[model samples]
Target: MKNTEQFIGKRVLVVGLAKSGMAAAGLLHRLGAEVIVNDARPLEGNEEAATLQALGIEVIGGGHPSDLLERGFDIIVKNPGIPYSNSLITQALERGLRIWTEVELAGLISEASIIAITGSNGKTTTTTLLYHMLNIGKKKPLIAGNIGTVACTVAEKAKNDEVMVLEASSFQLAGTENFKPHIAIFTNLYDAHLDYHGSTTEYLDAKLQVARNQTAEDFLIYNNDQEIVRSSVETMHAQKIPFSTEGKVVEGISADEEWIYWLGEPFISTKEIKLPGRHNLENILAATAAAILTGCKKTAIENVLSSFTGVRHRMQFVREFNGRTIYNDSKATNTLATKSAISSFKQPVILIAGGLERGHSFEELRPHMNNIRTVVAIGETAERFTEFAKSCGVEQSLLATTMEDAVKVAYESSSEDDVILLSPSCASWDQYPSFEIRGDQFIHAVMKL
Candidate 1:
């Protein structure tokens, strides 16, 4: 594989005008390339369009052009938000144009090795933990991907032998070609992103595509606890290393006797990790596999793992008022992750559940409602979830008209020592742009009380 500087002075078609797209367009324009950026929005009132205009980049509303595929591109920089099956992108590929995602573009210019993590859950926690460990090492590791900076932005700062840790989402990986990592990690996968993928198999396939382009020389660290991830990752080209709650590994990691174990030179058991929940223990396993593979000492991982406060919104302890502790777990956008969040609690929980439903059946989580004291549902999925809660014999459930009202009801309903958790098993698209916004709103509501 050779590095082609073909993009220099070449006419580049930048598709998608989000942050990544604007960044790509700006970068290309600065590099002496003719940059044309496109997006589906019909007008320029949003931040994306404003950024494009500010950059003096010609922006087009609505999808790709028909002439793009026929003429082909010197290079196509795609935003990770777009799907791989997009017709215009596919058509451009058929014409032999080099199509690279923001992540792929970032990897090309990154002078450092990459540590990429992907999963339906815990990616943010694991990514943040890895960064914390690097900080404890006193090294600067660029933490980017789905959570922070897009890959293309990082690629421009490539320095030799530097380590770039990325949180690659399935959306990012779907369009990534030649996006190799020195070490790639797969956390557990569950039913998620089905709206974009249309089915579980397709969603899993899109995720495993991270390893699909890798060679045996590369290293893959994954969770053995995930049957779907283990089965979907058929890439034997890379070294298959599993981190598990059970099973032994020649070069894998697992927990036994309440200690994290590894198979490497400084093979030692982690004694006291500070991250919350057993789900985080699984996250620690995935992180340890990546750390060990990258030659990070077991002692170092343990040291940071003890001090890690955990990622925000994944079982985040919001506040303690009137003997009831509130936790904002707005990031639990799927039923399985919500199930894990609920399981993390011992005291009876007053769960504030509901939001934009992704068409997931609540049957799996229904069986575990015995621990729920009273479920105060709100948002779009309130009716659907409240119905499910009742069907599961949830005696005390109410569908609130708004999030603030829901929070009020939940706090009023719970006794001292009971946990009030905002663990919506669906996205927040109905009322908010992101889970962070929804979580912040919940926090504001609670504070006002």
Candidate 2:
């Protein structure tokens, strides 16, 4: 963004008290924007609440005011959860007030060079891997956005020379107009966030925005293995750099056999990469392509890929339960991801699946009959998953009341050759605040058994 233009003195409305909301509010106020912040729920006098009040901003505890439409503001910086078609926000737009996501707003003020990764799956993994590479590459990178920290918070105190690796969600990208990244990655897209996006087309359109505003001088690193991402990217105006397992692109990247190829040059081999599944190898290729785009040496990419530890809650190896290998892959919040996780394992598995349903039905999960021994369903969509598993001809399918119970039952139902896996193909909102907490609890439950 051009530094000559700043929103410091402008009137802005920050919707929601999520991490992005609070960060935007505080930073906007600091930068001279007259901020009015509101959250759907009242703050419980937490540190987050205190931070907002310290910024001298007025807070509407719960709900956006009806007057928000009548009272004019320069811009409405919305949280990702609030649909873009919100009546109040729509009315504000009609009245001539502009709207922006905190993600977009933060991108404008960041001093660090942005390296962003977006996809339905593997975003967090790619983001974490890029951060790990840049973090130890010179100790000059901050991992943020949908995966690590709020981008605004990281930008507020970021060093000018440091690189920022962010995992951008389609929800965050949907309403953005001018958020630019130096090196952008579109990891393999799948059917996800359907509940909010309304359709698969809308969701893919949202993800495409990562490259939509980028110029020819900027770099777009995307997945070649995903047909939709590959096809849709042709319309984008950015200089395209494709990465995939299928084939290498001219002046882009690819994964051939055990090696990670970047710009037609093999930087790292998958045999030495620590991350488990082929899905993660795809993520590494995307990250390596971005890193190589940023002028990091092939050896640097190879060095980091070998040392990078996988993201938490994403197929995290937890513990063994009475000879049963247990994994906490609670971050597999969609059927495609859960399918990838389960397909990676060689053993017949005891799978723990379900949570807050997010419009995901069971078609993608049915083909893994040979690897799955039983599926222990739980949470809101338990019955739906159980029915689907039964239809797939799985002999053992049961529902447990909670993650603790699910772990217990999985331990009981497994043998020495079986893998007890907690790879829930749904959100963790039913029992935990986030996937990390759900994963931690899963590990705790496994240790008990």
Please report how far candidate 1 places residue 358 from its true position, in Å: 5.9
Q: Where in model 1 is the C-alpha error above 4 Å?
A: 1-4, 42-58, 84-87, 198-201, 213-217, 247-250, 264-271, 297-299, 357-360
* Candidate 1 weakest lDDT stretch, 10 residues: 264-273
Model 1 Cα shift for residue 182 (angstroms): 0.4
Model 2 clash pairs are 8-32, 8-33, 252-263, 258-270
Off-target runs (Cα >4 Å) in candidate 2 are 1-5, 41-54, 307-309, 319-324, 355-360, 379-387, 398-405, 412-417, 428-434
Give residue 70's error in model 1 in angstroms. Answer: 3.8
Candidate 1: deviation at residue 47, Å? 6.7
Q: lDDT (CA) for every model shown?
A: 0.78, 0.80
lDDT of 2: 0.80
Tens digits of per-residue lDDT, candidate 2, 1-449, equal 23525876788888877788888888888788888887777667556666788768888775666776555678888888888677777777678767778778767888888888888788888887777666556748888888778887887777778888888898888858889988889987777678788999999999988888788888888887778888999987788888777766657777767666666766666788766677887888787777766667666766776766567788776765567777779888887779899987887889999999767677988887567889899988999998988888887999999788998888888889788888888998987899889889888888887
